[model samples]
Target: MSEQAAPLRRERRTFALGLLAGVFGLLLVPTCTSCGGADESQAETRPLVLSTIGQIHDIASTLAGDDLRTEVLLGAGLDPHTHRPTRADAARLTAADLVLENGLHLEALLHATLDARRASARPVVAVGESIPAEQRLAVGGAGALADDPHLWMDPVLWAEVARAVARELSDLAPAAAPDIARRLEGVLAELAELDAYARRSIDSIPAERRLLVTAHDAFGYFGRRYGIEVASVQGISTESEASVRHVQELVNLLVEREVPAIFVESSVSVRGPRALVEGAAARGHQVVVAGELYSDSMGPPGTYRGTYVGMLDHNITLITRALGGDAPAAGLRDRL
Candidate 1:
């Protein structure tokens, strides 16, 4: 087999295994009343919204307020790209009154399980798909066009997702429609402020030094929205390994541009970013790993960084400060 074909084959194999596992999980879902199967009484009391990732959970929770119950399947530091559904996850997905996922293959491993749930006539929304096609960034190079799933990286795009979630929540619980709509208004204003803050913070960085290098290509939306150039060691999906040639190319870019700082993702391995630092050091460029950015996940629940606004505030502030820009040490609302 050719070198390129090897990775393609491996990806296909991995995806197949994940699908099989998810199907198996569904089959094993507990049917007994005592085994945590859907309690129709409880579900009717309070609608449960299961979000595939923290970013979606944050938005859903913000719009839902106390009207709905929101929970996240993937936690902080967990890479959704490689996460397979467990038996419990299958049960929750089955029981959820409404399911919200980033879609665009972000939850590639859970696609089969989510599909099964949808096939059963359960409500499942891929909130990221709510964004207009033209607003989404296309990936896959010269091959078939695919939408990048990391829309949450841009606050403006994320606001659209927030609106989508609001609509879903309102539909799920019509009685809460007024409350959801009110909360949605507040969330949209907050996201707009976040977008403006990100642009301002990023603009403060010196133009030549405004490049952001990270472990993976999760920040394309962020860079496009904030006027920074984004390069990564790995592809958009963390499922793909970083190629040596790609690393060397990035090293060359770092050395040639004399870029000061690179970033590591909270949910991704630091080896790739560290390798870039070492590669640049060997060339005497002296690059630093500025700080860990929340890419696939957010911070721990109940904390400031755990929230959607806090997550972006942290990223904007950290990137600005690391790249020699001016930003408040405490971030947008003195929360970071």
Candidate 2:
């Protein structure tokens, strides 16, 4: 086999094996209806659902309803691409009834730790991998990752992830299947509405100024889904270095298109886009860092921007206003 195909084959094989193992592991969990009312009461206790990122945790928490205790290993603004597993994180990983992750190499540093847990019959799943290969976008850069893990940027695509989370949580807590499925339905409907709002709002931008430039190439999926042209300094993985050539290319595009605004990410350094602005200035073209976007992470907790809906709302609101499109200042539902 060729070098490129080898990894693809291995990934497929691993996923297939993991799927079987996960199902078998679920079967091993004893189901006792003998206690009747007692068992039903205890079922309310819920499982401890651990996720890798806050976004996934939030979605799972919403889907898990009030029953499951969902928590994330990484907090707001942490870059998952380079985050390493600490001793405390490892302890939490083992303690979780079921661990949820983005996968597609998003948690590159924690693969070994997650793998170890899965081998021991602990349920560790990369829910993002549940999105089919055909749906994922490819990115390019020196030493960059092959697939984009930022599926959450697009609500339509994220609905796929929501479905995946519902399946895994249902498997772990069969007694709560009805509740979980009900919540999943509600979440999906909200996401569908959000997707429609995004499409309408983004389409308002003038065709010429609909270009979206950011610090990194995390918006490929977003751009594809929303009908916007995207450019970036770095690759899919934030770990990839930004070359001057790439920056210059983006600067040229900015200048050529006279793109009025670009954006920075909360989790990625502003240095990349900052350089692009300076480079554009040198050539008599001006670009502003219109706003900060939630790329790899979401906003602070207890805030509107912290939730999955809020994250996308912020992106849509910021992009529309900055790109000369019209959107309610507060966003789709005046909830910003």
- The best candidate by lDDT is 1
lDDT of 1 at 90: 99
Candidate 2: list runs displaced more than 4 Å: 1-45, 141-145
Q: Per-residue CA lDDT of candidate 2, range 204-253, in tens? A: 99899889998888898889999999888787889888888878898888
Q: What does the lDDT come to for candidate 2?
A: 0.89
TM-score of each: 0.86, 0.85
Q: How high a TM-score does candidate 2 get? A: 0.85
Whole-structure CA lDDT of model 1: 0.92
Positional deviation of residue 64's Cα in model 2 after best superposition, in angstroms: 1.1
Output the worst ten-in-a-row residue range by lDDT, candidate 1: 30-39
Residue 162 lDDT, candidate 1, scale 0-100? 88
* Model 2 alpha-carbon miss at residue 52, Å: 0.5
Q: What is the C-alpha RMSD of each candidate to the true structure, in Å?
A: 18.8, 20.8
- In the range 1-336, model 1's lDDT, one tens digit per residue, is 699999999999999999999988877765554455456654557889999999999889888888888899999888999999999999999989999999999999999999999999998999999998989999987877799999999988888888898889999999999999998899999999999899889999999898999999999999999899999999989977988999999999999988999999998888999999999999989999989999999998889999889998999999999999999999999987
Pairs with backbone N, CA or C atoms under 3 Å apart (clashes), candidate 1: none
